[model samples]
Target: MNTIKVFIVRENDGSYSSYMDEQANLPYGLVGEGATVAEAMDEWNRAYNDMKNLFEEEGKEFVEAQFSFAYDVPSFLLYYAGKLTFAGLSKLTGISAAQLSQYANGYRNPSPKTTQKIQNALHAFGNELSQLQLV
Candidate 1:
């Protein structure tokens, strides 16, 4: 099992910052100054959701268990694991929901930075179904 790791940093403003080094590449939130841990957590959820939507938009497949190309995991494995809604993802990832919808529907694609950020958000639970033994 892959366990996700996270760290907290205190800011000069007396708020906090959360760095999620798991599969997700981008950090979760800055708790410094006026932000509370709750706020940071809210940010984390929002960011994570957006990345999940990114995967969905990309036409990726997701596998719920150990699967082979024959059995197959959905290319969007992380998306499933993350349990994100498209609107939610947009709110968190800062990408327009419409754009994300286009990506998921296969009308468009996300940029490199977007891809990296999405991966960062999924880093903790990166490989979901692949970890299964049957594949």
Candidate 2:
């Protein structure tokens, strides 16, 4: 099965949006909006299911693909804020807590390099946790 990339972003009003890029080259566009990430993702899945049903009813070909959801920098930071404090994340990523807070609040956007650094830090932390053994 093919994989479709879905991007999740936080809007200025503190709402969330999930959408597929135009470059997906699909027959139709998919989008969902909600007040939170989980709600947005649920709506996005509903959109896909609705489209699938429409194609089936019209006897059209429905593309079968999996979705890979990715969060933008601000969305990621905001979503994980509860589980990871800015001070903790600052230590993990070697970035200042204030700067991270600014990114989370949408006051500033991170450069591509800084974004990669954040991703790398999170992935490394995940890897370290995965290697843990509890007795």
Candidate 3:
């Protein structure tokens, strides 16, 4: 079954805001901000539909894999894959090793192009792993 979640963040300054969206399964969008939690959920639903339609039109899988944006899965996968070191990724991405470290630490999300490179890196690494397994 597909599921969605809402989390609340209270800024240190005393403002309260809420974010609502489906996580890994969201093909449409990750929505943030709602006057109330209900409002946010409503917005997320609409945005999700819009995203789904757009991706569908483009013939792309908007939600091909459940990407856990705030997680260590990416880091662990890259480390265990032995395909790209932080330094290697930095060179490949033209993003410094520090930036790559930040990415691995879940401190930031990569820009679209960088994210594409990360995905591409994972794909290539997986292909290599498969070949090695057969050997």
Best by TM-score: 2
Residue range 1-135, candidate 1, lDDT tens digits: 223444444454645455544453332221212265556556655655665566578865422111011101122422232477667666556667677666654566677787666565555334654575772
Model 3 over residues 8-64: C-alpha lDDT tens digits?
543334332344444444534455445543454466556667877888999897663
**Local distance difference test, per candidate?**
0.47, 0.92, 0.54
- TM-score against truth, every candidate: 0.35, 0.92, 0.35
How far in Å is the alpha carbon of 53 misplaced in model 1? 0.5
lDDT of 3: 0.54
Q: Mark the regions of model 3 whose C-alpha exceeds 4 Å error after superposition.
A: 1-84, 91-94, 105-108, 133-135
Q: How does candidate 1 score on lDDT?
A: 0.47
In terms of lDDT, which candidate is stronger, 1 or 2?
2
Of candidate 2, the 10-residue stretch with the lowest lDDT total is 20-29
The local lDDT score (0 to 100) that residue 78 gets in candidate 2 is 87
What is the Cα-based lDDT of residue 20 in candidate 1? 46
Residues 28-99, candidate 2: write the lDDT tens digits: 779999999999999998999999999999999998878899999988998888999999999999999999
